[model samples]
Target: MAVPGCAGTPPQGPAPRGPRRVPVSLWAVPPVAALALAFLYPLALVVQQSFTPDEGGTSLAPYTEVFASESFRSALTTTVWLALGSTTGCLVLGFVLALVIAFVPFPGARAVARFIDVFLSFPSFLITLALLFVYGTVGMANGVWTGVTGASDGPFHFLTTPWGVLLAEITYFTPFVMRPLLAAFSQLDTAQLEVASSLGARPARIVRRVILPEALPALAAGGSLVLVMCLNEFGIVLFTGAKGVTTLPMLVYSKAILESDYPAACVVAVVNIVISVGLYGLYRVVSRRAGA
Candidate 1:
């Protein structure tokens, strides 16, 4: 004696299970394995080579010799100072230019802002080359000076000096700072600027109080990126023909290619990688905190 509805329904089995699905994390394995093989493996080789000596045993002798060398010390010092100087210059110059492009309403301002993106794609060596044309020994500046003053040699011989490298780095990397700044600035409230202006705040005061606070994160990120890039820069130094400017990367090139000192090259490369990775890690932490 089954009830009309309750007993009419037979027992229902469990809902149909779909085909076994892979865990989401498992999908990441292929890419991670590929990365390990492609990048991590080579980096490990370099690290291993850095520890290896010409005598063919794993030891720190190569590092000892390389670090003790005068060239390594000079290159390390030059690399640090140049990277710091270029980063400072880029931050200052980029901030000012970005401010003008973002706030000062002028004709072609948008065009100029857009041009920064294109500027970033231009190779670093191109900027060095361009600077050479304008400031090289017989370039425009020297040519004009020579033609006007009738001097045998122009006064612009600094093109192959450290200062020239600094200038080229600033010129090439400034746009990197500016691009992030512009993005940050775009999100800034126009109303605040207007209110500040109406409340009798001077331009400089408004910038200092209002604009700068909002821009600090972007500035920090941009500056960090420029710092790392400057640290690793080889093309600009090489193209500038700044024989005097032997940075870490340039030292690596000379050691590996010219001297055939693979162990020494690896040692310099490891140092550079450590610095770059440490800075990058710091940047990530700072950025995360800033965002929070």
Candidate 2:
């Protein structure tokens, strides 16, 4: 017999079993399998093609050829420079824009921010084309500059030049950098900012000590995204940068289309994928550290 208030002992010979196993639904399996096949299979094919030998069996000849070519070397260098320049420019401009939108008191600031969002939604190639209308040799800004200075030509040459491509990229991607940073800034604790201010921290000091650290993760993530976008950019470069600039993407296009060298194109594409993946990994590590 059990004591008072004690629960009665169970009379079962076996313990109660857990819930029955539920099989994954057929609907879910199809979508998952479709995604794997559609994206992963093509990517695997590209990687395999990159390794296929020009002469016969699997070899590193494609990669070796890419690295050995002077054109490839120049293209790689130009790609790196363009990516770095556009990324840095976007970061600087976007950070400043985000700060103004988030903290500063100004008329129509909300409207301006909304407009930026709208602008970001527009296609990047369209922005590049619009820039041609404003800064190209026959564009309005150049025309005005030429008229004002009585110069033989426009002060700026944005058509088919590296600078043109860089400028176009920065304009297009600045919003990419801005949106994440603005979100981060908006999420910051106002109480902490007030506390810092009450402790006699100057505006600059408070920003440096309190704000930048909190925003670093967003900045890093956005910058990495911009870098990746810039790395794979082909449309704008093809239009406004055909003169002297030769990026990896452009090389891949040229090889595939003009030379009909599918293997070489695959090789260039594989290199791009590796570089982008490596950079994204680095960004993730850095962002995690910053958050910590």
Per-model tally of clashing residue pairs: 0, 0
For candidate 1, lDDT tens digit of each residue in 159-226? Answer: 69999999999999999999999999999999999999999999999999999999998899899999
Off by over 4 Å in 1: 1-16, 289-292
List the global CA lDDT of all models.
0.95, 0.88
Candidate 1's error at 110, in angstroms?
Answer: 0.9
Candidate 1, lDDT over the whole model: 0.95
Worst 10 residues of 2 by lDDT: 3-12
Candidate 2 lDDT, 94-146, residue by residue in tens: 99889889888999988988888898778878988898889887889988987
Q: Which number leads on lDDT?
A: 1
TM-score of each: 0.93, 0.85
